[model samples]
Target: MRKKIQIVRHVVQLIFFILLVLVVVGTVCSFQIGGFQFTEPLGAIQVLMGGSIFFTPEKLYILLATSAILVTVTVLIGRAWCAWACPVMTFNEFIEYIMKRLRYKPVAERGKKKIELGEVRFATLAGVVAAAGISKTPAWCNVCPIGAICRTRSSGLLVAGAEMLILGVVFSANMYEKRFFCKYLCPVGGLLILLGKISSLIIPRASEKCTGCKACEYICPEGIPLFRNPDMSKCTKCLVCYSNCPYGAVKIDVI
Candidate 1:
């Protein structure tokens, strides 16, 4: 059985994000659709690239403030932003759930030989920054899924098509690699992962009670080896390990 706390927390997060989307994009919100200031971390990247081309000074200040808050929170709670907030993560989890229901032989299956894609996130982060600097515009903004989600439907076929293409690529890749986009591409998630390294939060293993069942290891979407400690930064704090441990051997602590 699934854990109630994580499920409830996730549902609440989804509801809050949907309401934000309703206000921002009317009926067109999604992973590549509607969003809010607190929903995505792209605005901060835009600010650091230069000033906001679209936001007024007041709004820019709010965006920066919220981004700081997000980073601070992540530093305190590990990468819980992905677990508890990100729309991309939320949708990916849904896609993963559906894939499971359909019994798709998920590529990230337990004991599978995993594709090792290290440093890609850092590279993409650098690429986005450089592209934005060279273009003197938020280069990725036009195609940012959160911005697209928050855009008006009148943007016509080009925007919609781009969003669909991006979504298709990411979702299709998910079939072969669970959360492939977040793991390998998303710059914002990369930033959060960087911040999470400084966070004291962690899912501690009660080695004494673990009994080597490996249930936690099997349930991890990130394929983290949770029998001991997971690959710290790779653990997104989903707490699936906590819930799946029949012996209740996984415990979270702020260290």
Candidate 2:
């Protein structure tokens, strides 16, 4: 079942990445299909912050409504969006594959962390909000990799150049540490991490007969020791531990 879930997740990721490409090519409109429009949580927050330091109640209410669906999902399933549908995550996996084929190793192995850099994502979130409020523009979106691909077509190559540079830096950093942006610097990820802390579904727990081996911890993209008092907020719900556990001690509890 775990292997099946992994296969299903890969398929979902591919489908979403294709949809993202369609948005880039003008084949599909972003955040909308037919009469139903949707807003990603970060985009909605930026809309509220970019206009004014003191936002109007109407604007707040409308953006809140538009962002509600995504927020609700985050609270239910943790960062399943990052694990299952993020275009960047698909790209990250592609990079991982290339690195593997090349036999390249990341600068640091997974479990050597001295500090939790994942918390830096919160600072990144604050920075994006501050940038919007100060510039009175959603300036971060101009360079955000997720939105940048879709924006480049309309914004022209000059603008796309800068966006790609940002994307390049983020992707290149993954060579130093896997999913570096997802772990440390993605504002959207930070927002989702915050929301996912309260997720009411898909909790992982270590079962009896589990040894103190750090296999699960070392394999986690976010470096969470899912087998040893895992921090669910930082968990992307990738289930690497559950799928790869040698002792079959990682039990996923759905509540």
Candidate 3:
């Protein structure tokens, strides 16, 4: 049952990533299909930070609405958006996949300190909000890789050059850290992590079924300790531990 859930999750993640590509391109080109629009649900942070460089004040309400919806969803479902549908997560996961294929996990993950860099994200979130408040600009948006991609089609190679340089740094960091940006530096993820603490959803565990093997701990991307009472706020809801457990020990349920 857990295996089926994991497989379905991967399929959904792939489809969502493809759709995100379309949205990024469609948003830039003003492309649309039969009354449907793709760029509407994303860029919540840039919008919250007083709009992106390309964003006009005319659509300021739309940006605020998107950020509100993101908050609402986080309250309802924890980090479900970050775990599955986020474009940044899609890119980070792709890098992690490549690294995993190179047999990176067995060496780097063992005995490594859990990467709980929430403080870094908090500091970044403070910077974005403060910088935006003072300058009336989405300061972080200037360096956002996905934002650069969205604007490059209309704005030109100047944006893409900066985007590529940032992407190189992010992807290279993932070679050692694994989901480096999402774990440490994503400002929006910091917001989600904060709100998700109050989220009622949780990954339930049946302690009776657990052995001391610690397989679940080894599999979690965020270094979440599955056998222990894991912190739901930090958990991406990736369910890797639940799916990998040889025993039917790690049951997922809501609180």
Best by lDDT: 2
Candidates sorted on lDDT, descending: 2, 1, 3
Return the top candidate by TM-score: 2
Per-prediction TM-score to the true structure, in the order listed? 0.79, 0.87, 0.78
Q: What is the per-residue lDDT of model 3 for residues 177-230, given as tens digits with 9 covering 90 to 100?
A: 787777778777777788888887665564688886777766676666777776
Backbone clashes under 3 angstroms, per model: 6, 0, 0
lDDT of each: 0.68, 0.77, 0.67
Off by over 4 Å in 1: 24-40, 51-63, 108-114, 150-159, 201-204
Off by over 4 Å in 2: 23-30, 52-62, 110-118, 152-159
Screening candidate 3 with a backbone cut-off below 3 angstroms (N, C-alpha, C), the clashing residue pairs are none
| Clash list (residue pairs), candidate 1 | 29-34, 32-149, 33-149, 33-150, 34-149, 34-150
TM-score for model 3? 0.78
- What local lDDT score does residue 192 receive in model 3, on the 0 to 100 scale? 76
Q: Per-residue CA lDDT of candidate 2, range 226-249, in tens?
A: 656857887888877788888878
* Residue range 53-172, candidate 1, lDDT tens digits: 345777666666656667778788878877776667777888888998998866766567887887697887777788888876768776665455445244553557766777777789
